[model samples]
Target: MAKSKLSEKEQVTEYIQKLDPSLAETITFLRQAILAIDGEISEHIKWNSPSFYYSGDMKPFNPKEYKRDILVMNLHRGTTILLVFPTGAKITDTSGLLEGNYPDGRKIAKIKDLDEAKSRQKDLENAIRNWMGQIEK
Candidate 1:
């Protein structure tokens, strides 16, 4: 039998399953929090990590714009889970969830552990929703 390719979400699940239990819990919680914001947002493996993107119909634009990308989980630093928000410069964040400035229009939100993750859950979701609200439908 041919080897089957895992679905995007299944791949994400597998990725989370391989993490340290604490990190896994945090990632899973944040993933749920993000997905709960909008039904159009979907997940996949991108940039060597589990990434989320908008799957809804939108006005066509240049692929270089990366308008469909929502966020990608960057776990290179171990305990610190970094959510990379592409085009995050567009969001008017007041919740203090976003940090750092990159000329490429990328911003990052960092979560350390489950306690911090739970506390910042609302802020994180708000920031993501802020990103989603600007999407061209």
Candidate 2:
């Protein structure tokens, strides 16, 4: 069968569907919540994972700038899912949920499942919003 062209979100959803059930559920929840944050947020497959980009006034992401501004999820290791900020944007984390204290300013929020994701949803969205502002500048 010829593979039909799929929208980016569809492509990502397809990728998520292949994951272990628990991980898939967590990623799905995160994807929906992140997209709900802003209408301008767009996503695509980057580094073999679902990556989100904010295209406010700036030009949409080019291949060269793939790492410049992105919110990506890492699910390669195991049941634990990682929300990674590759560009090292300084995001607000009043809840102190984000880890990775690298000097480069990169950070990540580790999420285990739907419940944990729900608990940290507000913090994650706030951090993402702050990160978006950082990239806009």
Candidate 3:
């Protein structure tokens, strides 16, 4: 029998399922919330993890590289999950959810569990939207 292929979402879901269940659950919550931003927001596997993008068309980025990157942050070896804003150095964090100071205009938000992910949902959404706006400029 021919093998069926999994969609990008399914592939990412499957990949996360193999990690720590709590971390997987947290990531899943964030994924859904991120997708709810708008119709243009899309996701794909990047940096060997789920990456979200925002463009006029709902298209996923090439997995080979995070070209025109937006967000490329996730669980690092099941230790801690981070939401990276590769082009959001100037993005403000009024919610006090973002951390890390990289020189290359990158910022990250560390999400520990479903509760934390839930608490920071609004902030995450804001960051993503703001980041997308920045990229457009």
Predicted candidate 3: what Cα RMSD to the true structure?
3.6
Worst 10 residues of 3 by lDDT: 58-67
Ordered list by lDDT, greatest first: 1, 2, 3
Kindly list the per-residue Cα lDDT of model 3 for residues 54-123, writing each as its tens digit.
6464345554433356687566746678788776677777787777778766778887778888888998
TM-score list, all predictions: 0.95, 0.85, 0.81
Residues 21-89 of candidate 1: C-alpha lDDT, one tens digit per residue: 889999899889888888988999899898999999999999889999999989998689899998999
**What shift in Å separates residue 8 of candidate 1 from its native position after superposition?**
0.6
Candidate 1 lands at a TM-score of: 0.95
Model 2 reaches what TM-score against the true structure?
Answer: 0.85
Q: Please, what are the lDDT tens digits per residue for candidate 2 over residues 1-137?
A: 99889999899989999988888888889999999998889888888999898766764556554445557888887878888886544666778877888766678888988999999999888887776776643
Q: Number of the top candidate by lDDT?
A: 1
Report how far off residue 74 is in candidate 2 (Å): 0.6
lDDT of all predictions, in order shown? 0.90, 0.80, 0.75
The RMSD (Cα, Å) of candidate 1 is 1.0
